[model samples]
Target: MIERVKKYIRENHMLKAGDMVAAGVSGGADSIAMLHILKCIQHDMGFELEAVHIHHGIRGEEADRDESMVRKICEEWEIPFEVYHYPVPELAKEWKLGEEETGRIVRKQAFFRERERMGFPEQKTEDQPQFLVALAHNRNDLAETMLHHLARGTGLRGLAGIRPCGDGIIRPVLCLERREIVNYLKEKGISYITDSTNLSDEYTRNRIRHHVLPAMEKEINPRAVEHMAETARMLAAADHYLLEKGSRLLSGCERKDGYLFEGEFFREDQIIQEYAVLEAFGKLAGKRKDFTALHVEQVLSVSEKGIGRYIRLPQNLYAVRQYEGVHLGKTVPRKAPESTESLVKREKYPAEDFWEIPVPGSLECPFGIFEAKIFSYKKQKIEEKKCTKWFDYDKIKNSPCVRTRRQGDFLVVNREGGRKKLNRIFIDEKIPASLRDKIPVVAAGSEILWIPGGRMNEQYKITSTTGRVLELHYQGGVLA
Candidate 1:
């Protein structure tokens, strides 16, 4: 057992010379066997070892006995030991979380606190001594986890089950079967305490262990647990490879606010697209708890819908379908205007809605500053810049206002005064729906003269008979 565990540790690079390993020993058969195995191999592996026991503040005398047994074993073996007590039941209620989840959280907190107290660096580096927390998950546990995830509906990552090593934690005895661990402990004459909770069917995992797995082993394959563990290892490898590919696909799709997934993203395999979207969601949310395959599907579904459509998500995030791609971010765009009359009749508009541009002065608005100036038309070379436009100044019927689109907003599409609604123009231009409300348009009432970075109304174009030129320059925002 020691040789097999050593091989597994080496394969996973769980330790190196001068490293410190803190093992969680709960006086159960699996953890006790793991502590013994790690103790036997620590000298040969050139690493230091210590034992940690968590008292979950439940089960009364039984819990105390478990902690006492673990401490006695550590003392006899000359291994350093530490114990942490947490009121898991009380904390569960206070935190508004399940007891199981609260227990897991406290266990992790205790392990990290021990690491910090030992003067170990939080982050591992090649040149410095590394610190790791060792767990005692066996093959049977891995199989149980896989079945649990499968029953609850999960993707590849969930199906991969318990990992041998991740995020500074190591599971050295993961390759060992439950029977092998019990037999080894018996041969060594080492006493261990079993939690009474394991005997009850109250927990879902206990029910699986007591009934589901035994039925599978009897009616189906005798080595069902071993087979499931093997399958989980394979799935873990595939998941790692796909996540790397997804990360590569997400590159260059970053926007100022969040990530953008365009048509090229959809061209990839559906699985790859899902992984990329999942990664983007995780990045923006800062965590993946409660994020499921269903959420990923919802975000992807927006791609098939019209531009400006969005799905509200957990963590106050949103995934908006843009003209070019799907944008994932925390910013929620303002609601779109239903009609021009509704907008004109509103008693008030946001400060971003309107700013009058003086004939030869500058005005600041939500999108940016607009500078207007009149100059003599001497057949000067018209610069073809998106931020700068030349219009017939004498043709202006009213002072132009820099604002967002309103109902009945139209642009002159032809020399013969043919008009195009702003909504129609946006549809023809493929502008994202969310952006239509934000794009600053130079308008004279409902007649839009110029959509900076896009087209200008034909009526405002410079002509040979024009005597004065109105040059409007935009200085900021998306268009700029």
Candidate 2:
């Protein structure tokens, strides 16, 4: 088993000489076996080894015992060790996430923190050795994950299950089965602590492990886990191939706002198109948490719709069909305001919902800091700039607030007090329909005082009768 793991690590290019490797040891058979194997091969492999243990804080005394056992093992072997404790249940509530997801997040945080403490560089270079975290996922774990994803309706990436290595982490014992890990530990007379939760079906993975996998092994095939692991590897290879080809095709589709998939993009095979859309969405979202195959299909469906048609997606993103191609971007603040009576009835606004501009002070908004100051009128030229504007302090009937456009939003179009709806101005300016919602406006009641990149209300223009000039400057918001 040790030799086989060594060969797998080498083949995967998981480590090199002088590399620092941290193995996650949970005091379970799988983790214990992996730690021992890596310890045995560290000198030959020319890498440094340490153990990291994470306590989920749900198992109480059992969890304490597990931590103690792992610490003792590392001490006896003279291996550097680190342990992190997290209240997963409490954190799950605080983060609005599941216990399982919370645990995974904290575990990753612990591993990355350990790497930083060990003085590993943030990025890897050709001349430098790597800093890797080793996980103890076995063939059975891979099979279980595949089954879980299948039950949840997964895509090719989900069907591929776990990889040998990714994102600065490696699974050195992924080739081994659960039974093999236990047999090896028993042969070596090593003891391990088991969590009581594993015996219950409270969790989906636990149910699969306790019932579904065992039934499949007994009735369907004795080597079901092994065969599933093999199948996952093949699927991973195919997924990788599609990802590379799709990425190459998407390379030229990059746009200032987002990727623009031209008509030529539709000529590719449908599978390749799906992969390319997946890649683009992932890049825009920064993470693919709730983005599933259904969302991918929605994005693809936009191609068949009219030019103005768009579909909302997770992470406040949208895919809109355009004359050139499909445009993907974030949803800007476009909610129109209610009637003026509704605005007057509201007593307060949450800081996140809207910002009340401070006279002679600065306030931060979606676009950036909006600084305002009131001074006696001076006989000087009002220099014009895209982000800066001036208004008559006394002519403003109400305190100005910075926010997105509202339903009755309108700007004074002439000295005669003629008004133009905000939407009409957007159209007259020929602003991209997708960008209309993102523009920030300063308003008093339902009347817009200033449009940062465009115009200020003509009613607020400074004149000989203007007693004070209210200067407003906007700093730092992306218009393009």
> How do the predictions measure up, each by TM-score?
0.69, 0.69
Task: Please report the TM-score between candidate 1 and the true structure.
Answer: 0.69
Q: Runs in model 1 with CA error above 4 Å?
A: 336-480
Query: TM-score: which candidate is best?
Result: 1
Q: Which ten residues in a row have the lowest lDDT in candidate 1?
A: 339-348
State the displacement of the C-alpha of residue 118, model 1, in Å, after optimal TM-score superposition: 0.6
lDDT of 1 by residue, 1-480 (tens): 899999999998888989889999999999999999998998899999999999999788999999999999999999999999999878876775456678999999999899999998778676788888999999999989998777755788989999999888999999998989999999999888888989987566887899999999999999999999889999999999999898888876788898888878889999988888888878888888646666677688778877787766657677788898888888875763333221121223353467888776656444555677677675655657776899999999988998888888999999999999999998897766655676668899889999876789999899899888888977542110
Task: Report lDDT per candidate.
Answer: 0.82, 0.80
Q: Model 2: per-residue lDDT, tens digit, 177-231? A: 9999999999999888787768776566877898999999999999999999989
Which RMSD does model 2 reach against the true structure?
17.0
